[model samples]
Target: MTAVAAGTALLLTGCGLGGAPATAPVDTGGKVEGTITFQTMQLSPTFDDYLNATIDAFEAKYPGTTVKWTDIPSNAAARKVSADAIAGTLPDVMDLDTGTLAPLGRKGLTVDMATAAGDVKDSYVATAWQSFAFGGTGAAALPWYLNTPVLISNKAVLGKAGLGSSPDPTGYDELLTRSAQIAKATGVAGFQPTETGFANSLLTVGVPLVDETATKAVVNTPEAVAFVTKLAELYRSGGIPKDSVSAKERSEIETFSEGKTAYLESGGSRLKIIKENSPAVFGSVAVGKPLGDAAKRTWVVAHGLAVPTKSGNLPTAVAFAKFLTSAENQLALAKVSSVFPSTTASLNDPFFAVGDGDLTAAARRIAATGLRDGRTTVKPPAADAEYGATLWSAVQPAILGDVAPAQALGDAEAKLTKILQERQK
Candidate 1:
């Protein structure tokens, strides 16, 4: 999940095992009066005033209702949520990403937002709304904030490598070609394919992670083999870093900041870090659309509000969630933070359509446009870390030249098939 304020990238660890069976849908009863505990992840101190004011407005709008707000540190949030869920003490309204909410929805710990508040379905972006649907359950959360990746390149590095200051590659193949040119000319890696564990790399290149039924893995196709083979070749030619094949997002950013790599693909909020840490590289930065297949789709990270089915006041909890994600409230939050709003009306605000000609502003504008076609990339059933790790572990050996790409993908397919079967059973 991406942090709303800092755009800090966090890995989606796999879900927990063993939970009580599904419960009946939450009954709101049309009375929005009661006290409900609301929990958010790492939005304090900086966003305290905005959140408090929002809460105050919510309280004033619906008299006799109170919101008790609590903020959890990002590092401890998942652990705390898991513990609370096991204890049946989850907050009535909680902040979560689809990655975190899906598992809970599978266990019926979360309210089906579509059933509880389906009338507002058309208010959100179709893709953002659908992201929360999982395990045959309707939408499990109300979409809040969102972000998408943009390609940030250091023009100085590109110019030094004879690629000119404004090098633009339309897709992955051209990106690889440019990467090789930069490495050959400047002896610096041109790109660092940050190990996402997820099959984002494959997805960008038009490879599907699974079949339509999602009961079988289909990533062992010829296109997948060809892409893996290219990655192996890039690694052998010093066009990409050795450690990068297993490195995290922080390492990728560090390499680009230090001028060891020419391009960094990340959220627009990350430009703040680059400007703070490496003004020299930041000065020469150019923003571009994310490189991908014909769909031109980019990866989106969304944060949403989920109401636990066991909430003491389902009606009030659900009402608060709706109020918090309202177009007006979401746009207000977007004005004060780096995150984008998940609501369709919020996105249409004039703020997203303009840029100030600065790199960061340009990135925001580009990212906003990207979000129109944006998606979470990997959908449920295969969205968990275990599934991603299975793909990565099988393909890593191929990237390291320890096995042929086809053979590695075959192994991955078999493993994924078995895992999916087990999950279905």
Candidate 2:
């Protein structure tokens, strides 16, 4: 069966092999007073004061309700959440991204926020709200904060390469050419895509990682192959870092901070770190739109709140999730961080709509503009992550000259097909 079909069957039979209760419809109305544990990904300690204050406000708004919030480190979050889900101890409300929600959604572990969200649906950005709808399922999460990609440049290095003040790349080809020029002229890598995971790179350029329905691989298309080839060429030409094949987004940020790269692909939120770690580079920093082909569209990374279907306090949990994602609360979080709020009402606040004379404000405005226009990349089923990891691992050999791009993609496709077959069983 297709993954979606399998998921449907699984849900119909009760969400688990042990006969856990079937998924429940969201309950948005009625009295809501109970303790709900909220699991977040790395929002603690640093944002503790802000979060605590918000929780306090929530408690004050809904008397007799207690919110116990905990944050799991991002690196180990997936495994931790898996363990929790298996133990039937998932938090009542969860802060989740698209990738993490895929398996949960498939298992029918989350509430259908579309029904639960009520009038609040119109409060959130359309794209953000739409992102959490998995496999044609109704939205299972309430959109919260967003991070959108932008092309950040070191003006000094660009000037040294003879690229004009704005050095905005028109497309991937232009990006590669400019990167080669910058490397040759200034001895600095020309560019780095914000998310260095190869699959993510393809997604940024509007290449779908798998066929629609998530049943098979589609990465061997002419456009995708050309993208992979250009990336391999860039790596070979010294325009991309040697270690970048396995690099994460933070690595690119570090390279840019250290002044080792001319163009750093990252979100506007990085401006704070750049200003703190490399004040001089920060002075030379210029933000531009993300580069892509005609299919070029900006990417928005969003984190939202979800309630597990098995939660005993379904009404309370759904209520708390909505409370946390409400426009007032969302804007409160946005005021204290570089991340943009997901709600249209929050985005319309003077805080996001107007830019001050400062660089941070300008950066925020640029990111906000991008978020308003960008599309959120759809993550496939849980198995798609495995497929992506395999693809990333397999492509490095091709990029490093160990194999041809076509051969590498073909092998990856075959492995993905095998995975799909196994899922059918």
Candidate 3:
């Protein structure tokens, strides 16, 4: 799994959908003063100081407002939120992502941030803000932190393949060609796709997953079929590892760190993990722009602050949500982590522009450039997991050369179209 997939998995596991319709939005007319519960996903011991300090500052700003902070393990957060929603005891303010916020927004459990706080809309990147908007629910949360994938390569592996230590591929085709040569020469896999699956892979190559109305799947086109065929050929030729066809993100990292793979596409935040787990491999890694349309259509993952519609103190909750995502607070967090701030002004900080000629710094600089065009690429109105599962199940056979590429994609399109139709009803 790449860092992006690992982070996404953490968020997705915590997003549980409920069947009940929620209460209407709270009136936003009162003073921003009250005791409000705040919940966070998996930011505990390591960030205890920063979070407490921020909470203290918020309380100071709004005298009389007492903020109660609770941090939950990422795997347990979704269930806690769902249980609270059922009991009508949801936190006034919660940290959430697009996946966790979607079903709640659909059921009217969250405040319409875009409507209640429309004046602050321009404070965030347009795509980041839009990510929280679901069908007819308006924007459900305030955009917070974000990350985009960057290309990381092993110079030693590339050199062994006779490509220069710093060879750069202009696009995916060239990258694949180089990967094949590296595998043949060095007896190592050249690349490994994240276990999160290939939906993003198709999207990165210009394959439209849905039609204009989002009412049909249109990925059974010639371009998609050709891509799948190429992937199968690559798999058969040993350019991609056999176990990687079903391995998790951790496996992908291990493979790369062990020098079994030459390239990896992951969030820059992962550089620290590599440095800690495999110092030798980390020393040889180089950061560069993502290949192909990925450079132009970078996949972004964003987390946000949400206020439940049932909060006892809606005004205070919303106020804190805005304060937490403000340019100043966001930059403070970004300065200490690999995440980029959603606020436009935060990106202008010199820290993002400066590189110290090291792997981590280079990755941060490259990722910030990609963030200007970054967006959440595969957002279906409903049944997002089902959509990915359908694609993976249908495409896996073709990738293993057990089914024809065209037939596999045709089946996937048919199944995805049915899913879209069912969602419409």
Candidate 4:
């Protein structure tokens, strides 16, 4: 199988569905009817099709409701959402990142979703629910889906490293050392940290880049100092090649499949990609619980629902948002999309009770044990923001040893500080 056969594209974890949010309450369980326009991207092939199927099922149940969806390439969704907002012609329902929500909400372009999201609010996991920052209690913008990032490992690689199945690594120190050994012995990329793996971009590496509490960015701090130092050491040690800086989704996925890398970072949809594209690689791949230590927050990405303040079908949109994210629906979607659901009960489903593959087991690990209690939380750095671009510019050099760690960090910090502070002013 190949990427074409697997229908591979971008698999967005932390699709930014959950983030800063607002809440409102309204009552409507009867005959919900209206045409809602939605937008999706090139990232996930199933997004539009799955939504349309859901819309059909919903219309059948509700009788009079209708939904119209539009496909905007993933790269275009942001701009499309913005253009709609300006034209005063917005979809009744659409997906936007959490950061985007802050601006839209502040601009009064988004209404609180808690209004018609009662059942939805009740079903999703707490932290997942919290992502929306739904209106406190009994009030929230309905939640849509979730993205749980985990380490997808080639179990076979572990054997070569003289290690058994992956152990719970203690920290970045152990993690890097293991990868280094794997590379040196096998002549392969020991630990693969793809550009796609931004799970650590903000919270893990960015903690030092930004302020201590996360309200500010000091990316050039000692923490960044530590991060880049390890990165430079690994790069110079010949851990990974420099060509991967511009590689996209399938490249990293394919490399792991070819045994060129021992470990790679990915989310729920990765399992699907392997299953459909590279069956051989899929068989060799195994999953590990999220990597990191107590010092870092577990990376969590949830997709929630919101009403564009400009939505014409606000009431009906609220109803579907609630219905789609309900406990039953959450479970149902897991089967269709091959990703984890945002609700706790979904994990107990027999479908997830048994580990089928790296994809299945890893997603279940995150859903059942990782953040199920809401004790661990992770947020993506403002990746689509200037902070992201600054880090991107520095990641390659820092990881590949093109520049010194201190110099790379200094340049990144200066650029990022200037970038983030610009928005404040």
Best by lDDT: 1
lDDT of each: 0.77, 0.70, 0.74, 0.57
TM-scores of the candidates in the order shown: 0.89, 0.85, 0.88, 0.78
Error of 2 at 92 (Å): 1.6
Clashes of each: 0, 0, 1, 14
Could you arrange the candidates by TM-score from highest to lowest? Answer: 1, 3, 2, 4
Candidate 2: segments with Cα more than 4 A from true spot? 1-29, 193-195, 243-250, 292-296, 354-357, 374-388, 417-425
- For residues 150-203, write the lDDT of model 2, one tens digit per residue: 678888888987885644885577788888888888778886643334565676
TM-score leader: 1
RMSD value for candidate 3: 3.8
Query: Least accurate stretch of 10 residues (summed lDDT) in model 2?
Result: 1-10
State each model's C-alpha RMSD to the native: 3.8, 5.1, 3.8, 6.3
Q: Note the residue pairs that clash in candidate 3.
A: 1-249
lDDT of 4 by residue, 1-425 (tens): 00110101011112232232333433344446757765544425656566667778878887777877665554455555555655677677765545444344433346655544544456666766665552233222455566655667777767876765658454556777887787787766666555445325435543534553223556566666676677667766767644565344236776776667777666756777767776776777667666642444555665555676556676677777766766687777777764567777776677666665446755665545555555346352343344454566776666666777678767876766665444332
Question: Model 1 lDDT vs. the true structure?
Answer: 0.77
The deviation in Å at residue 308 for candidate 3 is 1.4
All candidates in order of lDDT, best leading = 1, 3, 2, 4
- For 146-166, candidate 3 gives per-residue lDDT tens digits of 867778888888888888654
Error of 3 at 219 (Å): 4.1
Q: Which stretches of candidate 4 lie over 4 Å from their true place?
A: 1-53, 60-64, 99-102, 114-122, 133-140, 165-170, 198-202, 205-215, 245-250, 272-283, 293-296, 356-368, 400-407, 423-425
